[model samples]
Target chain A: MRRRTEPPGLTLAERKRQLVRDELGDAALRLLARQGFEETTVDQLAAAAGVSRRTFFRYFASKEDVVISFIGLVGEQIVAEVEARPAGEPPAVAIREAVKAVTVEDFTENREKSVALIRHTLQIPALRARFAERQDLLRDDIAEALARRQDLPEPTPRLHFAAGLGLLAFAGALKHWAEVDGHADPAAVLDAAFTEAGKAFAL
Target chain B: MRRRTEPPGLTLAERKRQLVRDELGDAALRLLARQGFEETTVDQLAAAAGVSRRTFFRYFASKEDVVISFIGLVGEQIVAEVEARPAGEPPAVAIREAVKAVTVEDFTENREKSVALIRHTLQIPALRARFAERQDLLRDDIAEALARRQDLPEPTPRLHFAAGLGLLAFAGALKHWAEVDGHADPAAVLDAAFTEAGKAFAL
Candidate 1:
């Protein structure tokens, strides 16, 4: 049996790094919310976070990168889940399962914060572009995962199809969930979206 | 039977306007090809095209918008074809036919130019963002067509699914065709992609 290597559970150094990064991101978001994204500067963000100007650059390459810091964790968790699915599952099932596994719990846990961040990102054009780029990365990662499955057919169109559909479900669910405030759990909305997709495809 | 309303076959005034737009776009492309996107400016483009600064702004909102001028026509043609398909066809089939109708002769006619344009757009960040926005428009049009089909179920997930899948195939085919120096016609590549999608989905 293959042993699963878990993510290094936050070492002291790593935990400190994450705390600093989160503080910086929170400061950036607060500024963006108060004074539009275009008006907010790295200096303001650094000062708000109680860090040196250099520390902001240490955490993020650009202001746009800071806006999407959460995506790195989301991407890692989705890829890890996809990689860990049961052997011999079909590509579509595997991708869907992976997406569902990551989103079901995470989205529920951070519904309010997630919605707020999404609204902020959507309102800012540059941040929206970065968000799309992040989604593209996730799509490519899913594609790569599908490509590596030996049980799948050669030149697997299902790989792209599955990944694309999974993303569509994610985007559609997120949009719908954001539109309705205090309606239902975001995970349930995602489940319903997936159920709708499965029915649409008659899977 | 509903009578088709063609776009008034370009009035003389419209023809003159199109001619100027094309000339300006060609001049801009020439500049872009030589000097690269970032180094080129609207003033330089206006001078190269023999147009005033005001006229340049009238024609294109930005340099990035100029790169995506052809997309509006493509979107119109695709949506028209989708809406014109024989009644009672499956939504996916209608979408496939719609994409086929627009791409077949149009893409082949301008094969080299299309490939160069796609390559340039992919290489430029601003152009790629505009391209993605245009693609989102195409997806919305496809979704609208799918939603209008009486054969599909209510609150249709298939519309979203089919639109997303169709765009993915279109993108994948375009990238593949551009990579190969436009050796094969883009329409044929897209057709093959749709066929592959059908097989993948067991549709």
Candidate 2:
């Protein structure tokens, strides 16, 4: 923790590295949006980011790795959002808002590129399987988030089913958004899914 | 349709073939339970089933095919059960019974082998992917079942989410059952999951 209180030079260096990573991610997303994942190369991504090929390698092992990393980051943000919700909030409502936050924060800027990246990843069966596994882990994270704020805890079947239901809605929302070619608003889709899910699961 | 009206000889032949297939399947499950998927081979399965290698091939092209076929049958039975529920019944109740019927009808006999089969299949990553895809399709089937029973038709987001939540409980119950080494009563697990899910999703 003390490392965060760095000298001015180290702070600047860290900030610069983060900026380069973000730029490379943006450049890669632009290429993937225009050209398919296959047509985009790491060299082009490096050049577009104004970084050397070696620097690109330092950040992401491969072109696919960047997309995976982006997905991982989005999932983490959702979990964090869920955890950060008001402790008195209802679990279902908190989960819905947490997922809503993901679309707003992650896709508000360069929305088309984000959609294109989602479509690109959905096209790959292996990546989809990996995504499914992460969703499974995300269920655990959501449960932990809920458990932290409530009496539920790990191994609680109630938590498992609730988390599972949350992810099911999430996956459904994503599938619908991608099916519409991502032209429709994803946040709206998520809103629809969660609203429907709320009514569906209730008496 | 006239095939059913065939003479006694033809009818006997068809019945004999089904019994043989069932026997072969049981034998394969027994072997899988005793040894494992990798350790067991086509030849060994055939020998265990007391059938020739060619007969085993005729029944299943591969050892893996048999497992897939079994899983496919279970999934179909679950869908059928859901579809067969009383039209006036609540969607959640119907889904609960449909999944309960799976453990009852499939596990009443040879309970150990059934557990072993589930564990064996879950151990394989490729099979898990196939299972997830099939679960996606099952969601559609559940929606269709609900639509047929209720006034809601196609494109109903409520029906879609209801189906998704049902599958979520079903999957959680299965995962929990598998985690317990399958010695526990699976029907009880499903009961607990649905109950918890109901309480969790409610306002």
Candidate 3:
């Protein structure tokens, strides 16, 4: 078996910066867990991570941003995946595949941490608001990808709306799976939602 | 044929209060149209309506509240209508009927104002955030109502998620209808969305 390691070819500056950001994120989450979100300060986080306040600012704008920074990467991956789907695939299928690819494998890896993050987000009203805004941005990105496909019609707002709702269904399913005791796998829950949504449409 | 007049049982105090709120809302919208949303002030609205600043606060907490007050009323009506649906109807059917009833009649009478409100809400960032929050509240309300129906199994969160998405589809259809140049009735638009959603679900 081969051990996966960071590529050896990176510039020193780029590698150091990535390492610093990772350290800062780990410190921030640890602080968030030990001391509540409201109690944790940027200065404290900086000290905990062995980084200066200036370095902390360079990495993250604030404590809230530290928690949500991963979403941007997730959003980019989803857009790429959706765009990469076969040209004539249906909009819903493209969206479902994108959501599944991003969430199932990604969520499974950090199931406990992700659930804790969700609980933390729900408890903090400000984080909750920002999280919802992030979701909206992701929805628009998905919608744009769907709209740009040559297979879709010119007035694609309705299709965009439907696809966005489908995404929400998957999100809701994941939330349920995380919160409920002995719940099914998040991916299975989302798959059921998609299937149920398809059945409801048929009615 | 008889000419309809004000009902004899209507109270003078109730009518006066309503008249004042209407005057304030009208003045607020007119000012918002002339100046931008940020430029408008509660005092200016009060002066325009010939009411004291105290009276303005009594009616609305802030300028943003004025734009969203109507939506609050509509949301309450939607929840109530959904809860009132016959016992035998499925959760989705009840939700669809409730949303249809609330939007169909209101849109007919207030088409122009509704469009203006939608456009204004979209343009203002604060208003847009509030709009999203309100939608979240509406989703919860619909989900709760669906949960209460005994015909369904103890409502899982996925059911609520599906219902919430259905409501969003209805809302998205209405919004698109308002945007188009010669779109037909909003009710028809909602019906089409419901039909499409049904088809999506294979319901």
Task: Give per-model TM-scores.
Answer: 0.81, 0.71, 0.78
Per-model DockQ against the true two-chain complex: 0.29, 0.36, 0.21
Q: Give me candidate 3's TM-score against the actual structure.
A: 0.78
Better of 1 and 2 by lDDT: 2
Tell me the tens digit of each residue's lDDT in model 3 across B124-163.
8777666666676677777766666645545665556556
Q: Highest DockQ, which number?
A: 2
lDDT of 3 by residue, A2-108 (tens): 33454686766778889999999988998989988888888999999998888899999767888878766777888888878776777777777887888787677
lDDT of 1: 0.74
* Cα lDDT for residue A162, candidate 2: 68
Off by over 4 Å in 1: A1-17, A34-47, A50-58, A122-126, A151-155, A182-187, A198-203, B1-16, B38-44, B51-55, B123-126, B149-155, B185-187, B201-203
Worst 10 residues of 2 chain B by lDDT: B125-134
Which candidate order results from sorting by TM-score in descending order? 1, 3, 2
Q: Which runs of model 3 end up more than 4 angstroms from their true locations?
A: A1-24, A34-64, A149-155, A180-184, A200-202, B1-24, B38-63, B149-154, B181-183, B201-203
Query: Candidates 1 and 3: which is better by TM-score?
Result: 1
The CA root-mean-square deviation of candidate 3, after full C-alpha superposition on the true structure, stands at: 6.5
Clash total of candidate 2: 0
Error of 3 at A6 (Å): 14
The 10-residue segment with the lowest total lDDT in model 1 chain B: B149-158
